[model samples]
Target: MAILDIFVNFIQVSMPRSNVIILTDPASQFSMEKSSTTVLPIQGDYSRGNLMLQRIMSYITFLEQRLKEHPERLKCINHYIFTDSDIALVGNLGQIFEKYHDFHLALTFRNNKDQPLNSGFIAVRGTSDGILRAKAFLQEVLEVYSTKYMKASRMLGDQLALAWVVKSHLTFATKKFSRPEAFSGDINGKLVLFLPCLIYNWTPPEGAGQFHGMPLDVQVVHFKGSRKRLMLESWNLFNSTSNLSDMLCLILGSGRTKYDF
Candidate 1:
């Protein structure tokens, strides 16, 4: 429930108007009376194989239901930030939309040569045009997956397919050369802004030489593996102090002492 804590105490505390919509499975769903949160459980006992595809389908289903139930409410929202639960919010997200308002969608990309574009954190505009672009993009990814995606494992069929789509379709004009930089591209004519993974969907390895405990510039931190413990550590120490720099002691005490950055 770290996300719930981060939302209620931190995120909602600042942006009280924002709503948290969680699409989870029935077994893991939390039944709570959160005024600004809506938890909708997907109807299925989906196997571990290809859960990402199921989630994309579930998202489409949820949007269709919302369109039928509250079309007016949908019109009021200008954008939506799609991210995984494992990530923690430490920095201001308002800067992304404010700065990259021209693009219809924004996606984070890893620095790796294989599967560079990570789909964990996506910022999509909620306008009609943006919605159409998102729909088209997902449809294209699904199409590509059906025809070309050879999964390394059953899970994350969507991510791998997404990588193919980005490489083949989301082409930029000039070469991008920088870390933590934001650049724009087009996917079948739909504009998509690519933000560096170091700043957006960052993993522990990204901050190997730097201070990793919620840096002032990072907006989200994606704990991909055992690094998830860092989230727990941060939450445990969350109420103790207001200064984020103090988190270094916990990191150092945990047997990691390379703090040259």
Candidate 2:
């Protein structure tokens, strides 16, 4: 349960508060530990076009507040991991944490040649030298890309801001720094090495139901989009496959998923 922060969008959805379904159900098993699991109820003014921008701003604000509350924990860890609620713990997470100890940033996947940047999952060591470099890069993004500062700058999005910053400033000293098993091949060009993901990816030439009766080879199947149905679908597929445990543990720790509250 070595975690830094928790952010959820449950509070903002327009539904009955009492009946509101949350993604928290999946993580009920891991909540009892002494991890710093802070659940963030969603903010009211966040809109789709600027949701990412607002979240980043909120993250910075929350980090500052936490520092004010617990000044001693500032240097305890380098960076914090921001995980999407839909993500699951398929195996032990120690391997990913180890990289955070060694590098300034980490993610389960790498950038492709054309779009060599995937910001879905990131580990940011706040104390590392990379932070200084990223500061300048982030500043450029704030000044140029953010609608708050620059109006005419139409870019792919804010995630790219982080991706371009990291890809430009950070250096991988070893092969182990990257998550080699996260993704196998090109989105539509190469054959994925492990389980063929129908959830996280929707690249063409192969899609959901692409391999109707074929066995899956991936370790963890990340349901990056359309989460609720994706998880159910993955679970159905997982139950049918006997060789999934070994593959899943590569990403999520072998322990069961848990929740705090």
Candidate 3:
């Protein structure tokens, strides 16, 4: 099997029992039988911008409708949103959620960009207030997507929408936990917390040879931009040798010997 195939298999085998939902094209070959995981197949010829916008809209809409149909099911559950391409390298996500129990939404910053937040990976609490804020956030994004003025700007779709929300509504606050910075604000008289980027959604620097080490507590590694290949190669090497240091060396393209381990 190919290296990426091996990496994908490892992720499937090791994924936690949390509610993992994936949004992808219907024809994708990725499959999982976990009872806690749900794969929502998307069908459309949308542009990259439109596809992300629709994915967020669809997921929020599904959550809203499900809660409406069964209010009791909303008890004691948290909703996590991730793009299909993201990977969980290490850490139990349930623990991460527990650590940030007070936060309503958790998101990370984009690497090598001026954008303060990335919509690819997010965590949302299950409270009624959290759900309402998420719905409002999605609605604001939809409006931006629908408008020609904002859509014509450099950032479109989810990123632009999230940027707008952070600028206008979300307020930054310092938390005493591992990730000190968080965004907190009120929505319709309810307090909502948006956790810092380093807590949940961490991305490696962009570029082939730029290999600054990841934070020790990064829960999710978003292989955004052109670094997917590097991440796959590192994963393949790590699986074979089980040496994280070597994997880091390979990912960074440092002069360290790949066979040293």
Which candidate tops lDDT? 1
- Tens digit of per-residue lDDT, candidate 2, span 139-161: 54454346432232233465555
Q: How far is candidate 2 from the true structure (C-alpha RMSD, Å)?
A: 12.0
**lDDT: worst 10-residue window of model 2:** 2-11
Q: What is the lDDT of residue 156 in candidate 3?
A: 44
Per-residue lDDT tens digits for candidate 3, residues 83-179, read: 4454534455656456656665555653323356667666566676667766666676667655632353333456656666555654332222224
- Estimate every model's Cα lDDT from 0 to 1: 0.66, 0.37, 0.56
lDDT tens per residue, model 1, 36-60: 7788787854568756766666656
**Candidate 3 segments whose C-alpha is farther than 4 A from its true place:** 1-15, 25-37, 42-49, 76-78, 110-114, 148-155, 170-180, 187-192, 206-211, 242-249, 252-261
Give each model a TM-score: 0.81, 0.50, 0.72
lDDT of 2 at 169: 40
Question: What does the lDDT come to for candidate 2?
Answer: 0.37
How many angstroms is residue 76 displaced in model 3 relative to the true structure, after the best TM-score fit? 5.0
In model 1, the worst 10-residue window by lDDT is 252-261
lDDT of 2 at 108: 43
